[model samples]
Target: MIDQYYNHSTVYQRRTQDFAKSRRISPASTRLYTGASMEPYDEELFREHDVKRGLRNADGSGVVAGLTRISDVHGYRKEDGKFIPDEGKLTICGYDIADLIDNAHAEDRFGYEELAYLLLTGALPRYDELESIGARIGGLRLLEDEYISEFPITTKSKSIMNVLQRAVLLLYAFDETPDDTSAPHEIDVALSLLARLPRIAAIAHITHEAETSGVRVVVPAPNASSSMAEAILEVLRGGPDFTHEEAMLLDVMLMLHAEHGGGNNSTFACRVLSSSATDAYSAYAAAIGSLKGPRHGGANSQVTRMHADIREHVEHWDDDDEVAAYLAKILRREAFDGSGLIYGMGHAIYTLSDPRAQICKRYARSLAQTKGKGEEFALIERIERLAPEVMRDVRGTTKPICANIDLYTGFIYNILGVPETLYTPLFAVARMAGWAAHRMEELYGAHRIIRPAYNSVMDDVTYVPIADRH
Candidate 1:
């Protein structure tokens, strides 16, 4: 077992190194500084242009632009029919928002129905189309035998997400038609990957959990199940002990989160790699790396921790006054910015509420009722009620800064006996479908490489020798 583990580690490391090498870019040869004046400088005209443009809101409120890129397709719009860019140079903050948040953007923050529309439709796939995709993938479960055989299993107690990452890389390696981004095959590959990823994820989860707990290696029962969620639930339950309700909820959650808009970590990974003409596996591996970031796929863990903290101090959280004082103290001590920021609350795109959040919230409430423990539900309600008020008091705005799907999903999964660590992996399982869909779209569209230009504003200076630096 030890030798086998070392071998797996060696292979995994080699593959990782290879992936890094493949994705690397050589530095630009000609280094030109923007600040360097070209020939005759038009300072007077530049000043005049700046004065006319104004310091803020240079483009006026009514000006609108459309984007063909994955980042710009938030499904919701304001009353004026103008879609807000979650993260772009045009937004208040020039930083890119998390892909998950960007994908969930709707006219109303709480537009669950709109989200449902996106999930059913690939790029606004219609209701019937969504049903077809779901039906097609539902019957497809478990990875191909070759995939299962080639999947690298290390003895080290690895992060499940990391294992999934390796699996994604391997998927690229094993892709029979790495260069074929055309019709039927591309669509088929996307559907197959979408169907099997949940099983792969569950295998990773069960394998790692078994290793940690010293349980027997139970090869997941052959995929006799109809739905991908059911197959995974079987693996998790280890026998026929799993409940029907749990299976149904898991199915819905997986289906709902399968895809949103695009430009999320995994989807971005798909887009970036597909742009470069890489295969699906390579694209997916890149995405997994992006998802590893705390701001992206790791939000669920943070949400869980916040809930835990609140629950631990539930006695102290008597009323709005006490909650305000506690929150203020934490903020002051932590030097937190008054952004009304809370884990799993407020979306960059959605202003009303996250539809997924609503679904998960309902499921969580149901689970609480089933278990007859109202504490979690009560805590969620209190936080939901208090969060907006707290934000309003601190930030001078009472906009609907409700909890997103991550928070609700975290709550539901926690109540369902899922370890907090597996939360993101589960997210990955559901999101694999969306990632595959986006990758297929990019590949079919033959989009150009996603290399966005950067505008620098820093002053230029000459490099100095080390000895003469001072």
Candidate 2:
């Protein structure tokens, strides 16, 4: 069951425990941060500190715990003079004078505040509210059904992600525009899109496969439009043929990838829409565009390509020296960065290691064993060990550039019999939940249009009249 406070102590403890076990670290090794400051990994110590400091929990208890915003209420500031409180909003926009003038170390170049707003607010959607929104949105399941039925017979000319883009644009036509006091009504629209986006995405996949393979793919119409996992499984399995384990794994993946701390394409879309007070459709369109980029949702596809390239040359990589030479050649040529990147290695965030990557690695190992393709598992292991060394020597960097979650997710999905092309759309299916939650938060508050200031890099110049042209 979903909890009342999304970032409650129970939730943090559960996550910390899970992450700790996955990383093979002690429970005490998993540090819970109240604010932006990094602290020692001791839950009890942090809890005690909170209690003594009179920090209130989300439930208004005297003790505040959990990683969400407890520190915001207690009032802490970074060494750079930026305030980090346990309550109220924290703006991270480039346009904010404090962020620009004082917090010069802030890395975000655009829409940082919008990203923070989405992450902070969407972390905890009210349970009752989510249920109501889910119910209303589930009603829009027919749109997906119709779109799948009408999809073109030949999808070779168009990518699955492109089809998804078209489907979203078409679906948006059916959405209603809320009145002046439309935030409340718009909540229903946001919820509906979130609930059904996976179904539409999955259907797009099934239809694309059918068109490409000339095989009939059939899926049951969603009964209640419930969980995104259920909808995707219904489409993927096409009936009650899938085992309980398969369903469970799909659900877990959906939930895990639902949201991180923003800074993604879909979340960016939500922020952009909030800034303009535009409807969810327009906002989502912008998000879809962002997701198409190689640095973002395209990571999984890169993973597959990298795997294929390595497999083609696997016979030559007999030793570490050979691997090093090959990697140096690729790096010197800038092959991955320009010719097309090797997917699933490195990320903009999480310099240490991506938590999601760890989960996907576990999932992929299980899947590899299940499929009896031990070679795939072995390949991943080799890549993990060798890739870092290759990168380090080639780039002359000491830090390890490890494979992120997208790499493992791609391997897992491929082993599970999903087509390679559908990887990014699958990411979209998971992210829609976070997108909806962010939209809900934007509608609920004293809605501000997210407008961030930018540094003027272009030179100031005046245009000459056409009549005086040389």
Candidate 3:
């Protein structure tokens, strides 16, 4: 009994010390740490060193890094050695995205599964093949009870994406062969995650609401026969509280967001991690972390917040001059987070247009009209039209600019009753297909590690003794 008491005392003492050490850092120490870690580089140094900042060329094109058979993003053309803006085109595997959407809608079938299959395998599936694929993914939609009971929704994170990242990492512990990078195992893991992530995101959103509002939400068990889009809505709404049109619209959205070429930030992050021979879960978790950045998948939420601010401050949504004035203020760093960026207004590659945004714009208008939110949709449309002009006038640049997919997706989600918190999480759900595809490519196609060289700009200095440093 004495020995047991002594051991317990020692463990408790260690835990107490750890708890005390984990306390928030003092403000003074934080300032000192930030100052010591600060490293600022001059813009001119990039040009002098012939460096491609952010791996982007001077004309804003991504540096040709690797090849891809998954999808192609075409936004510009070169003519006579001059940069030329062109209508954006997104092709998945070998099929055009617009044609895929059109065919799926015409047939009145969910297309996200088909798109996912095409991304994973570089070919469109026949009817029977598509049925098999859907059945497999739908069957995997229901997560393991242990996972639901122990992870994600019960955790303390307010950010759904953070929960999602943890949920994915947690899966690594459950898999019997988590490190298997063979084709069959990798594909199975990818499909399982593609099915399970939407459910996790829905539960994470509910968990966040419970924490904030103290109202517990019960997520319904997923239907194995339901499509991915339908399953997400059912879980989030706690039942089948959505329409056929709503489900179809969301399915189209999933297809459009499923892949955006290999160079996209999240997919590239997945590729980079996969190139290092990590497990599928780690690579996917890294992709989720990258997507959570405000400049990437999180841009949809930023766009929503910016629109909300415009709705609150602007007097009239219909008046072009009034909207233009507010947008000019945004571009001039005088309003809306003061970052000098009209969020969702431009794309890195798409200058003339974004094909995904074009489709969403059409569907968003129809849905907004039905939901009696025509005025709000009109305001968003107006912003899309006027933001480029305002930017040109404010910044004095002649660059062609157009709205990206982020602009209309938030409006669509709102009409569907999705919360702002789920905006980026939903992006992760859709882009899981892309990230998995890229991971496969990096593992199988690219045999070498991705190691980019960085040019050091800091001057070498002699080390001083600890007593003489100050």
Candidate 4:
């Protein structure tokens, strides 16, 4: 065990390069951060062995515990972007994401409501069951006046995620059964947050927008008949009207973002917190804080800014050579901040393409065509077409750097008139459903605290007197 070697007599190597070579690991690829850089990010690239084992079972025996897979939560799985195992389809809770999307597009109901049900329960629902769940969640959306009055609307101080986090923490004031962890109580909390956070998020969006634009803003009465998407849109519009097709598209997007299995940072945070027997609000709030990080949820806004920069630099929107050259320059530090990083082009998961990204790209393309604004969309397409090979050549990253869901989401938000600030907040709004589900699963099944131990690298540490310290 690496922990066993931590002592004064343990022959510690001074340099990471020498240590890597001695351990037969790649000096360039081997990464071990001291102090605070290591933030629970266990990547497959960092695995010491080919196969994974439990912490006590693994002894840094080259097992490469690079975090290939962990957690028992089931999501749509595919091999090489094809679901060859189960008749070439992706299934989450026995419901194919593709089929769910297709069925939602075909159905009159808001697909997201059904998706939330599927995630909360382990099975897909019949029409009546789905409708019943929808009405149940809808009725749970009401908030007391004092609760509504205390909510934060505009903030240059706190982050959107923090606002959501504090909002959940504040729910403790209204919560009479804070000590309750029963399934029925948890489900009630989950459904209430699912229905209510959106309204609060929508108000936050309008307040922020109006604050920025110097316009006095007020939220109108919510429509009881409106679907989730329609309700969120109505709050934004300050009325009870929105186009049906647009709401459908928004519903699909929200469904797609609802859950990505339990391994994701935010969802994992929810499970871990729930394992500590914390209330659902605390667990869900931890997830919001996790999603607030740029590496996780904020990538969407970064992509938006990246697109703006690319448009300013590229002289010809259609030229392949121009796009390639600009991309190369950006990667090579000859242009654009010299960071040598490409945002929204790579996903840590999925070797070929993220299926959700493909769906989102199609929606973005159709929207562009309908609106007759293809320049930026065309530019995005060009980057997507060329980025895989270009990024591979630029940085020797082991994984395929293809388009991910973040690629088009920011643009889609812009198309829907959502402020850039609300991108991550809205992500939290949608992901709350998944967080609640995970929290419930963790609390109900695990019945243990998720406390993990850390190993220290330093072996020799002697206390010094104040004079020696000086």
What C-alpha lDDT values do all the predictions have? 0.59, 0.56, 0.88, 0.73
| Model 4: lDDT to the true structure | 0.73
For candidate 2, write residues 1-470 as lDDT tens digits: 12333435566556656766788875455564222132123344445444332233432223311122111211132356433322211222112222321232233112122222233343323445445445554576655435545553322335667766666666565545533326555555655666566666676677767777999877677766344555666677775566655655655455446565344456656665755777666666667767877778877787787777666765654455565555566666654444424467665433455656666677678877878877767777677667767777666655436667777777777655567767787777666655655555555552567654433334677898989854
Instruction: Give a tens-digit lDDT track for model 4, residues 1-470.
Output: 23434432223434444556778875445665222253232334234443343332232112121221112222224476443211122346766677788877885668888888888887778989888878876776666788877776322333667777888888876889966889998988888888888887777667767777999878887666667888788888788566888888888788878877676778888888888897888888899999998889988888898788888999898999888888888888787656676678865444466777878898999998888768889989998998777777766554445677898998788888777888898899888878877788788776778776544444687999989873
Best model number under lDDT? 3
Q: By the TM-score metric, which is better: model 2 or model 3?
A: 3
Clashing pairs in 2: 71-85, 71-86, 72-85, 72-86, 72-87, 73-85, 73-86, 73-87, 137-192, 275-450
Query: In candidate 4, residue 46 scores what lDDT?
Result: 34
Q: Which segments of model 2 are wrong by more than 4 Å?
A: 1-140, 144-157, 178-183, 213-219, 225-227, 316-319, 334-340, 398-400, 443-446, 457-470
Candidate 1 off by > 4 Å: 1-152, 155-157, 316-318, 333-341, 395-399, 463-470
Residue range 258-364, candidate 1, lDDT tens digits: 56555455666667777898766677777777776667778778778776766665465546666565555443444233322477776655555566676667768
TM-score of candidate 3 against the unseen true structure? 0.92
> Model 2 residue 452 lDDT?
44
TM-score for each candidate, following the candidate numbering: 0.70, 0.66, 0.92, 0.81
